[model samples]
Target: MNRPSIARPRRPRNHPDRFLECQRAVEDTVVSAIGEASAAGWQKDEIIAAMIAVADDMQLALNAKVLLSVETELGKLMKKYR
Candidate 1:
């Protein structure tokens, strides 16, 4: 399966500060998600599945459109979560 690429603005290739900033942002988001899920009484498997589903959806979103397989997977995931 081909992964879709997002059209993002070019960043400086050698910029450690920018790279660290982006890494920190992703880490913070993930930490926040874990805390919220735990507070909401989610089990480990539920949280892991949710994270996987969201990561897959994010890829579709970044591509600015969803392919057929992506759409099907998203629907299945939503139904499972719901």
Candidate 2:
């Protein structure tokens, strides 16, 4: 069976752009959501749900461009990556 591969963002490790920066950005958003939810007496699951929603949006936006240009889903998927 062919499994869908997840896109892994990689910034320059040696240069100023570090791959972990992307990870950090995602964490920061999640943290901000959690803090706001906590301040408003909202459940922690709300933050998790928001994060998942944001991830889907991000993926759609990121993939939309390549999705239009490529012929096959595999090709679009490959180009959407890096």
Candidate 3:
């Protein structure tokens, strides 16, 4: 018996051009940072660690923002329903 495949929800295709520009800027910054680090004689492990640290910090900030947004929406919903 063959299993049925599930259809995944597709992402919307209406993202703004600013997002693309921001993505390109981030890519360029990462590339430049890697090149500079290498030129400064940073070890492979050191570069990897620095990148991970930066990523972790960004993740924390994003998580906090998401949490705050969720809480604000929940408050609005509660007020509306009450």
Candidate 4:
């Protein structure tokens, strides 16, 4: 049975422009969060920790997206071969 396609924001594989846009969006979010945290009197260490946590979360999310894309392509190849 064919799996239903889920619509997602896909970055074109032929260009890095969308990838850069994603990075810029992440950076903007992190900066804004840090500013708010600082304004709330978060200490330097606390702010750095928050930044690191955000970065880690972003990396994990990116990795998961790449894995999902690879898995979908692999499934397509398998079906084509079968």
Computed on alpha carbons, the lDDT of every model, listed in order, comes to 0.72, 0.69, 0.74, 0.75
Residue-wise lDDT of candidate 2 within 1-82, one digit each (tens)? Answer: 2223334557665857565666665665557657777778877887678778998999998798777666487787888996
| Top candidate, metric TM-score | 4
Per-prediction TM-score: 0.46, 0.48, 0.53, 0.56
By the lDDT metric, which is better: model 1 or model 2? 1
Name the weakest run of 10 consecutive residues (lDDT summed) in model 3: 1-10
Comparing 2 and 4 by TM-score, which wins?
A: 4
Model 3 reaches what TM-score against the true structure? 0.53
Model 4 lDDT per residue over 20-49, tens place: 656655665666666777878997779989
**lDDT score at residue 79, model 4, on the 0-100 scale:** 100
Q: What local lDDT does model 2 show for residue 56?
A: 99
In candidate 4 the C-alpha lDDT for residue 66 amounts to 100
Scored by Cα lDDT, where does model 3 land? Answer: 0.74
User: What's the true lDDT of residue 1 in model 3?
Assistant: 24
Candidate 1 per-residue lDDT, tens place, 1-82, comes to 2223333334676775777656655665676677778878998678988898998999977775647668889999999999
* lDDT score, candidate 2, position 6: 39
Candidate 1 matches the true fold with a TM-score of 0.46
